[model samples]
Target: MSTAEDREELLADVGDRIRAERHARGWTQAQLGTRCGLSAKVVAHVENGQTSLPLYYLAELCCGLGVTMSALLSDAWVMPTRQREERALTPRQAHILRVAASTGLPLSQVAARVGTTRQVVAARLSESYRLLGVSHLPQDERRAAAARIAEERGLFDAIESYAA
Candidate 1:
């Protein structure tokens, strides 16, 4: 279990990452809000850590930002309670993401091999990204975003390399 303070810190980080991604795309809060069917005030709230949006709205944010929900979340999405360290992706989730990033395989095909449906795989990937605090950008964009974050954290080498 996590302490309240831990949760707050995680949400704040999530908010910061969202703001960074928005800025990376050169989008104003109003512009991003318009694309996500949110008001500028709502966007401000989300970006400033004043509030947390529902999962569905976060998904919309991913779509509006042209990133995968996973790409938007990054690795700091969760911190282990006992170890007080970052969470690592499960092997299955990592495999799916690496495959998606490294290859152009359709989610359905990936699903076939992974023994899951496309929707499930997508949902899992999105959840994994949320766990990792990764964004959901297209492969190239996601790689760049992940690389930048990893570099800042001194984790570029440890972070998984996405296919170009």
Candidate 2:
């Protein structure tokens, strides 16, 4: 079981992840709120890293995000405990990851977009491979995998910009 602090962090991270995805789809808070049967304020709160609702809200969020409660609750979305040393990658790495995840752009393309070398992009992707235990998949492959688990319902083309 997680401590209260851990739970709070998890809730906050889930909010961030979901809201980011929602925004990527170009959906506004109001639109996501409607999808989740929440008020826009509530959606804003959640996206602002404030998710303090009952389990039903979790269900609604999952439905709205086209994911499952399990995936949302999974460590990937859940915030890390304080004791956990894990951290997000550096900006360059993060940008590389987002592009790779969103478009699965080739390493050369990612390097071009980020004004970096292919080797740098390759190194960053290698880290993801160590963490995910496989080479990262193209957007399509990820969608296929998600579909097997009833996940990856669609694209979030809203908030995505080249992480300049």
* Model 1 TM: 0.44
lDDT of each: 0.68, 0.63
Best by lDDT: 1
- Tally clashing residue pairs in candidate 2: 9
lDDT tens digits, residue span 1-164, model 1: 56977777777777777787787666789999999998889888887777866887788777887777676676644322222236556555665665565565778987887677999878767765665566656654663354344345543333345312
Clashing pairs in 2: 23-159, 24-156, 24-157, 24-158, 24-159, 25-156, 25-157, 25-158, 26-158
Best by TM-score: 1
C-alpha RMSD (angstroms) for model 2: 14.4
